[model samples]
Target: MADKVRVAVLISGRGSNLLALAEHKRRDPDRPYEIVLVASNVPEARGVVLAKRLGLRTWSLSHKGMERRLFDQKLDTVLREHDVELIALAGYMRLLSPEFVERWEGRILNIHPSLLPLHKGLDTHRRALLAGDEYAGCSVHVVTADLDSGPVIAQTRVRILPRDDADSLAARVLEAEHELYPAALERYAHELRGAIGEGREGGSDD
Candidate 1:
């Protein structure tokens, strides 16, 4: 397998995670994998704009165009067209249809604000602050049909100061997301290359 991995990013809003990935790629010009596609349900998604700035291929599809299944089929086609080996979800607000989740399965990953399985959904930073927690964190994990219920790959922890508010905690957690997501993706790409190599060897030897 070639050294650089192919990655596709999916986003609905601000592409913080995508930006993080791009930053990582910039610092390591010799890395084997590079982002090949960026797709967003929102046509004006900032992530798509960011992708274009990075000179990577990008596309936008309206999520309201068809039944969920039809939409996923279109999405699947887009991903395939780009030769995407892995997918990362960044600021995507919609709940992915199960069909699409199953299509990618272990190949998909997402960064969630809270330390997942804890806050599970939105307002994570606020939730943590409201609960009077001393620490807040971000998580990168494999995507499954269950929302934010997949196996975690890595995480970064940030300490919440005594006088911290939601915004402050969120800012720190967002920083963690930046550091964590790219590292998680690198690991995922390395793992995929290994699996592919083994599969090819076994296939040829049979």
Candidate 2:
């Protein structure tokens, strides 16, 4: 079998989804990818601490004063150094520069708090509640140049209750995110691995 695809996860907050992904990988020995690095823009992020406890390699630097492109360039260097093949964004608050997005292209995925094409930016849960929607959900999608405008890989919907507020709906959506993200990544990685195999096998030696 081919070696597992190398993945890096970026987080800015508690990294609940990161933990879920790590736990899923640990539980399933045959997963198609391995999270080789967990990185964060916040040097003191809790996710960094959690990654350490999980015995995963980590990289972190404060993005406060740095310019966007410059920070992304430095981050790109670290990712390349780790030979990362895929990137998963879990609560990563910063917007990636367009250049950086083009560099990785379809190789990156992000978990959004709401079903995309509906709520593209922040305050998604609140907006859903205000609109009196019947359901709110989380989506895992490929990262593109446009914000939250990527092709969705998968989604998990949480039904909105009669008394649901933004916070309550957010919490339920978060739980769904934890479940959806790991499973989505697992399947996507498997597809990527198969594509690589097909390419190599179909190459002609001229």
Candidate 3:
């Protein structure tokens, strides 16, 4: 763990993407960052149970009762408690407010199911199929309050076959996410750590 980085992950449902991230982290134990935190806005998010089973720290600050300000404050506290250096949003459902976004600006990253600036919101799989997109893909970007408007870090695309439907396209995009997200995180970590030495390489942070 000499060059290890600290990563905290957020999710709102089954942490399939988080699980993938965890698996990738495990694959390279010598690499920077571990899945140090698994948090959910939903109390019953199955991922929390899974994380606990794996003996990882888990938290649920349910969104039902608290206001956004309070909720985000609680989230910030938890993130700080874990000494998180990077924040990854896997299946987190809500839009992060400007305050929270600014608090962790440039340190937050998210994975989206489609090549962004196209389908910015939900139902990307169905929308891509209905719109007859020639290709569907996934994007890994820095997080911003303007939804997926953050600077692009990396992306990978897959052809939309004539026979492809929402479910089929969703599966393919997920595979792309699994591949792209980890690579993007690795590059990001390496560049960040390299900079801590003397800011020698990597493109300017957007």
User: For this target, which candidate reaches the highest TM-score against the unseen true structure?
Assistant: 2
Best by lDDT: 2
Q: Tens-digit lDDT track for model 3 on 90-192?
A: 9899788789999998899999998987798899989988888999999999998897889989999989998898998898888889889988988887766
lDDT for model 1: 0.85
Q: Report how far residue 10 has shifted in candidate 1, in Å.
A: 0.6
Arrange candidates by TM-score, descending. Answer: 2, 1, 3
TM-score to true structure, per model: 0.94, 0.96, 0.91
Local accuracy of candidate 2 as per-residue lDDT tens digits, 1-206: 45788999999999899999999999987899999999999979999999999999999999998999999999999999999989999999999999999999989999999987788899999999888888899999999999999999999889999999889889999999989999999999998888777887888999
Tell me the spans in candidate 1 whose CA falls farther than 4 Å from its real position. Answer: 1-3, 204-206
Which TM-score value belongs to model 3?
Answer: 0.91
The 0-to-1 C-alpha lDDT of every candidate, in the order given, reads: 0.85, 0.93, 0.85
**Residue 73 lDDT in candidate 3:** 91
lDDT of 1 by residue, 90-157 (tens): 88787888999988888888999887777888989889988887778999988899889999999877
